[model samples]
Target: MNIHVSYPSRLYSDKLSLDCGSTRICHDISVAIPDRGFTVIIGPNGCGKSTLLRGLSRLVRPSAGKVHLDGKVISDYSTREVAQRLGLLPQSAQAPEGIRVGELVSRGRFPYRRAFSTWSDEDERAVLAALQATSTLELIDREVDTLSGGQRQRVWIALALAQETPVLLLDEPTTFLDIAHQIELLNLLRNLKETGNRTLVAVLHDLNHACRYADHLIAMRDGRILFEGSPAEIITPSNIEALFGLRCVVISDPVSGTPLVVPR
Candidate 1:
């Protein structure tokens, strides 16, 4: 494996803490998600993996410290300004009743629109390109509520891509997906990163998938980050145990040649 030295980081945390109501879900987590890379955060349920991701996305306010975007504190930016630089795909998207795919995707252009402004040609082109990229162009006229799980997910990704941000974050994008859809989504994300369209950060539950696709990996447990590095450096048996509390043997995946964890 080549040492994947990161580009200058644009999104990072400085001793950030996240809260769910009055209960703290994450402790002080100072971490950097490398720019223009595919980074996967993995840990057991309730370990604050998604909480940390939400903080980075500014979907949740940091209870302590800060998240930085482009070397500036993210909170300093206006909501629309932040939306122009970053996009987020939550675990499950709730589309309006009977909303068509195209209409839902067009919402991504909200950051660029002025009050009562007409949708620009650039917005049209972006929405079209995003639909094509996700292979959902044919579904543009279809209602979002009428699509299958896989199809809906692709449409949701198209919506995010339409935003045209330099950074994108996903919270367990594969949740409730079958194996085939999960692979499809991961492959799409990898392609997004490889094409230099955006920096990718995802919270994932599957350790093997994280190892297979991540250029960098973060492991968390008990509301704190425990380890972070390239998968080859961080997916050792001991680290696996520390993060997931399972004894496992780590081996090279025959297909991708990334680390594969086999629990004993």
Candidate 2:
């Protein structure tokens, strides 16, 4: 759908905190993400990066404070209504066994469909576009269970892309890939950013990849934001130490010219 949509403004959390059962994963945190850029969330393990992303996507309800999507309270939106505007690829997603790639991708059209309605021409076009965008068109007939780790990951991304949401959230998308596949996936996401007015928020484990691919970076520590800005402004030895408790040297990436970090 080529709708004339305004790029969503920065998502804001007003003193957001999350309680998973009894444990507090994220504390009172407030931050505004940019509207039309790739924003990566980084920190040491258990620093609440994924939790924060979940809160932003409204997948996990917050214990305190509120999350605002374009000034509207996120909790106020219906599930399908929210899905129409924001898509999320969680850290680990399980596809039904033996499902074909095309079928799986077509499921992304659910939010855009009326209850009990069949797929439409627009849905087919979207599924096709997503498969093409992720370079998975050739695998459409293949069973998702038979694909390699990288290919499966791409298929998952294609599903999200098929949703055609303005805001995309990914949680550690490169987790199972080798170095080359990791770079490939990051490059694909960068290309998607260039192709439209999309807002990407990814929880990334690799500090270097986050710095190189993200237009903006949010460094979290102990459930609070340690820093947020362009890579040049947020990535530094001191910032690294504060976020990950590591001493690292930050340099410029020869290819992307963004920050490149190496641990001591």
Best by lDDT: 1
Worst 10 residues of 1 by lDDT: 1-10
Clashing pairs in 1: none
Clashes of each: 0, 0
Q: Where in model 2 is the C-alpha error above 4 Å? A: 1-10
| lDDT, candidates in the order shown | 0.90, 0.88
How far is 257's C-alpha from truth in model 1 (Å)?
0.6
Quote each prediction's TM-score.
0.95, 0.94
Which pairs in model 2 have colliding backbones?
none
Give the TM-score comparing model 1 with the true structure, all chains together: 0.95
Candidate 2: C-alpha lDDT: 0.88
Per-candidate alpha-carbon RMSD to the true structure: 3.0, 4.8
